[model samples]
Every structure is written in C-alpha cells, then in structure tokens.
Target: MTQDAPRRPGRRQAMALGAGLLTAGALPARAIPAADVQPPRYALERGARLRVLRPAKFIDPDEAIFNENTKRFTDRTGIEVRVDYVNWPDMPVQVAVAYNTGQGADVVIGFGADPHLYADKVADMTDLAEYLGAKYGGWFDLAQVYGKKFRTNQWLGLPMGGTTSPVVYRRSWVKEAGFDRIPNDLGQFLELCRGLKRIGRPCGFALSHAPGDAPAYANWLLWSHGASLTDEEGKVTLDTPQTARALDYARAMQETMVAGTMSWNGASNNRAFVAGEIGLTQNGVSIYYSAKTSSDPAQNAVAADTEHAEMPYGAATKAPETALTLNAMVPRYTRVPNAAKEYLRFMMEAEQYDRWLTGCLGYWSQPLKSYAESAVWSSDPKLAVYKDAMDTPFYEGYRGPISAAAGAVLENWVVVDMFARVATGQQRPADSMREAQRAAQRWYRG
Candidate 1:
C-alpha cells in the first residue's frame, strides 16, 4: 500500500509545492450519437512504449480490470504501455514536473481543471475529442467544459470520468429523523439534521482542509445559496451578501454536526459512518462499496442500511455541484504522442470502457452519455444518484472560466477555509467572507 490517493480530491497548492508554472448542463434523455462519424485511425509507432500517470486505483477491481484492458491493448497493437498509479496529491506535482522537464509519463490522468492549467503545454486533442464524442453519443457538458481550451476551443485533454461526492447516509437513520427522503430545501434539510442530532446521531460534514470532502460540502453550501467566487470575466467577486448568507447557513448547520467535523479529513466521515458514530455525511460511494464487500458482520449490516442521495440546494435551487472531474492529456514533449493518444482511445472504446465502468462498482460516473445504459447504474439502486454526476453544473471555477488562478484558489482551499471558520465559530459570516474575498483576489488578480 504505497499511500494511494483514496479518492481524496481537491488539493494543496500545486504551484507552490511543485515550484512550477502552476497552472453544465444536462438534458436530453437519450445520448446524442453520431450515426456516420468514424473514429479516427492512427498508425502505431514501431516499438513504441508509453507511460501513463494517474491517481492510484481507489478500488481493487478498478486496477484489475484496467490492467487487464491495458494488456488487451498491448496484445492488439504490439506497443507496450506502462500505467503508473500514484496518489491524487502527487498528480499535479508530477504533471508539473513532466511539463517543465519535457520528460516522464507520456500521458497523465489528472483531476479538476488540470487540462486548462497546462493547456498550452499539452498536445492538441481536438480531433480525438471529436471522434470520441461522436462515437460515444457525445461527452457530457461538464466533460466538454474541462476537456477543451476555453478561448481557442482546442481539446486539451480526454474527458475521463470522475468520482462524485454524494450524500451517503443510513436509510434507517434518515427515516428515524422523520424524513423518508432528503429534502431539496436547505431549511428542511437543516431540520432533518437537527432531528438526527436530537437522537444522538448527528450528521457530520467535513470542515477540515480535506482534498475532497471539505470542498464538496463548501461548494454545495455556497453555490446552493447563489454565491460565486468570480464573475464570467474572471474577476474576484467573492465578498457578497449571498456568500455571507451561505456562511450564516453553515454556522446554523454546524450545530447539527458531530463535534469533531472541523478537524475531519477526507476519510474521517467514512470511518465515522461505518462505526455508527455519525448518521449522515457527504462522500463517494466507497463507504458503501467497502461495507457491501466486507467480511465483517457489522459492516455488512451497515451496508444494508446505506443509501445515496444528491446534495440539496439552498435558496438558489441551482443544479448540484460535483467535487472532481478527471481528465487524461498528452504532453507535447512525448516522443510517441500517437501511442499515448491511441492508448487513451483504446481504453475509451465501448468494450473496454464498459468493463472498466462495471468493475469500478459505481465509484466512477461516466463522462460520455452512452455509458448511461451500463448495468452498473441499475445493478444497485443506490448507485443511480452518481450516474448523473456529469449532468450537474460545472463547479471547479464556478461563474468564471476554469483557469490556473481558479485552480490556485481551489488548491489554496479558500472556500473550504471560509466555511470551516464559520462552522467552527472562529469567525463570523461577514468576516469569513471578507477573508475569502482577499484570499481569492490574491490569485485572480495576479
């Protein structure tokens, strides 16, 4: 176990750590398919070898199926491919080093706005993107948002699917709290938490600087209240009345949480929920997956009681926001760009992609629409909520374009810090908003 990134998302500032350059939608029931578009063909380079860097497999089966698929690709093309799985936090660092040095992995799979951060340094993927989108019934809106370079509309990355943070909870506990279902209204949602708290089983949302869970909670709180970090022009516009209101709401909601959530990391809530210490929390489907596949009787019982739901809107009633979007890109320095791109395409083909998706056990939501018909979604009723992750509003930068600066804001944990301060009683709503505003301006204005 080499400290694999456990679907723990977001991250600390990569530019500072690596010392490098740093840097919607929905609808339509049936996925749009290209009836006549043919997938692009590529000539494999003789004796070509490729190394792909991606976040370590969070689930064991994901690794198994992926490796098996890689072998299939190698067997078919006679090109060797080496897939290196690393921690999520290391992804940006490695990506930065690769782009800076013009060596290392030929292709890299990274999370959240990474493509845009190195858009200029990566190979042009427009043709590949178009081919995949056409053959696979089209990429979801959020996928397109992350896959293409904003100003030029050039494809910077291949849209790989991502892990989604949904509301994972105990069905029995929710019913005990007097709610057969999670409410879409924030006010009613708060009351449900209050009831859970009164029963000595409080809801627990991460308030720490966790890479994934903390930002998931923070962004949902802010966006659901109509608060945004920047305008469409990318100007810092964080200090707003709506943001203050979101902070206040967080303060109120804090009362219904477990006492130590302010210090919880990405894995904390999962541990607490399975241990029967917390009644509710936002998380990937990993907890349920673990419990379902575990040998322990108590864990199995926990799995039986588990369920997943989408996060509710606050006053804004906007579409829910997601925690991470994964992408794959080829650096311009790769000696075998064709081999790298071909590897990506081969893995994304329906046959391999479908198998990989099924093996993931619903932990990953597909970026392309055709996979919506995958059995993984219908295999377990609880998994249905995650299948629509691509339909949620694109959240990495929010009202602004996804830029290196926005990545800096996220890596800096500005939003997470703001919400945590209010929830922990360390600062008032207005003070936290002001602090967040100043923090975001430092990056956006630079």
Candidate 2:
C-alpha cells in the first residue's frame, strides 16, 4: 500500500516495508486522568477540521478503530477530522516536505526520535502535557526526553503511546535447543543461535541500511553490552572499548546468522522466520499475528509454534529494542490549536485509549505507568512478555538527547553499516568502530 514509502518501523509498525505512502498515521510526557488536568477553558470550535497523517493501523485488522474513534471525536465535538495514511519509509521525507511547504496535517504521528527534528515546526503542548501527567501519572524518562524540548523542557508534543518490539521466534525450536524459555542471558542467546545454526536453522538479524531494523538491532546489542551511541553529556562514545566489544559480539553473531543478513530489510527477518528459514529474530508481535492470520494451516501451525521474548539482557542492559515511541505533534502552521489539543486530550482518557489499544491488538503497549498493570497483558500468555519490555524501554538516542544530529545518524544507518562491515568481513571490529566513530563525530560536530 505504501507505493510512496514503506519505511521500516517502527523498527513504523515495527514491521518494516518500503514501497509507497498511504496517508496513515507515542507516549507523551504522560497519559490518563480526564479529571486530573482542567481541559483548557476555550470551548471546542465548531466545524474545526484537522488532517492527521500516520502509518496504517498495522496492528488492527483495519483502520476501523481509528475511523470509529474519529467519528466519535467528531460527534463529541463537531470538529471534522480528515485522516490520511502514509507508508513509514515515506513518512520522514513526506512529513518534512509538508512542514517545509507549510502544508501539513494539524496533528501527526511522529516516530521515536522525531520531535527534536520538528520541535520548532510543531506547537508546544506544555499545558496539555502537564495536565495529563498530573492527572494520570508522571512521565517515563524516555517519554520525557523524547517528547519535550530537549534543552527547554517546553512541551512540543503530546505523549501518545508507542509500539513494543520483541524477539519473536519458534517455541519448539528453542525448546529443542535445551532451553525451556527464550534465552534471557546474552551468552545463552548466542549459543542458542549456534545450536540453531548447526541444525541448519540459523538466526537472522538485519545488517542492511534499514531505518527501523538497523537501529533496533544496534541499540539493543550496544545497550546489552553496557555501551551507548553517545554519553549523557551528548558526546559520541561509539568508539570505546565497550563498543568494540559489542562489535566483536556482532561479528560472532554473524557466524551463526544467515550470511545474507547483511542485506536484509525490516521484513527480511520476519519473512525468513515465517518461511522456516530462520529460528530467531527481533520484531514487534505483528510477525506472530501474521502467522496466526494466514489462510494456510501450515502457516497457522507455524503460528502455533511462534512465540515472543524481550531481548536478552546484558551487563549494560538498560532498555529494550527501540520500541516505537509514537508521539503526536501539532505543526506550528496549524489553524486550530484548541481542536488539536482537545483531540489529543480526548485520546488520553482511559476508555478511548484502552479501547484503541485493544483494537491495535497487542502491537501497542501503554506508556503510562498506571496502565502497566492492565489486564490486556494479564489476559494472554503471548502478550505478557511485552509488558516488562514496554515498561523499561529507552528511547533511540539513549544517554543522549533526541536531536537533529542523532536523528541524522540513525536515518543514515551508520550504526548498522558499522556492524555490517564487521559481520560481512569488510573490516576488522576495530576498524568498523573507527569508521562509525568518524561518521558519528561528523554528525555530532555539526
């Protein structure tokens, strides 16, 4: 559908695809509490219309959840909401073009590390954020960092919820490898890959220039090894001994991974897994759902064996894969601040938010701390593993601000390419580190 741009997640839907754009469509500073924050004093503007662009409802069977939500929102407040869907890959360029041309949606679904890039182009929603946090709960560290003005702490977007990523794999294969559950320790996880490889079923990891998969893999690997892209002081620390060690781990990982992983995109690993080409890989739950919905019973059987686990932790474990932290922002050029603000506020209420989350299936996990204990997770075995990962996720540019520089580094896939060089034997682990260090330094220096 995204003939224009099918970007990798979100990893936009954490199901990476690239082809086109359909008008489609974050946690915030915080969520919940219709009573906690006083709705702004201004009356809802009658006939106020809004256009919101986002990725398609990948988690839902269709966009009906949003269509219904839109209908209800308009019904409750006379505002006409025009929604469009865009393919994830095309979103960054299209959204930027919209902003640059002063022609854009009143409200938009921005990805994990986007607010900083559009901070000035979008309106500050400090009041709305404060109200939500006060009424619902305090903002998580990742939410606070990604949603606010990095230097000013001024609200630039409403903390909408985001997608949670997981290592979706075959349960039986893992069991056969002498593990009762998915590996929770890094060492065992790699050994599991070795075991799988020996049995003619290797694991797959994206080593390509995937906007979604690349960063997700890099950050997860780096963080687990107790390393980071940058330090808290915002310096590029990718060249450290710790980072070199992470690279070494990746190179070793390649031995057990399919060689073609160096060229895989967001969907490559999923395709491989469902096709029975690979036994393990990281992805959102969509992969499992994909198998569950297949018309083929064999595929359904694949779904039966399919399961998920959060990435195994490491000495440096602090966050999960860069889960899609979907946030909503209003462009500065919007004509209806009040409407946009109210639209955002309406979404945070428990009834609407919870329902929307359900409609999205388990693809979305809540960012609000209070929702952490929700039965949505308790209700199913497949979904329960995600709750902790969602609660503990760190934003893409961990130990650093989500800024233009960091965004540039990610969009360019410097980290992935760096790891690829080592995995593909294009460079030594140390040389790959030096190369990525130079690339990151150029961006940080700017």
Please name the candidate that would achieve the greatest lDDT relative to the true structure: 1
Best TM-score among the predictions, by candidate number: 1
Q: What do the candidate models score in CA lDDT, each in turn?
A: 0.79, 0.71
lDDT of 1 at 359: 63
The alpha-carbon root-mean-square deviation between model 1 and the true structure, to one decimal in Å, is: 7.6
CA-only RMSD, every prediction: 7.6, 5.9
For each candidate, give its TM-score against the true structure.
0.90, 0.88
Model 1: colliding residue pairs: 9-211
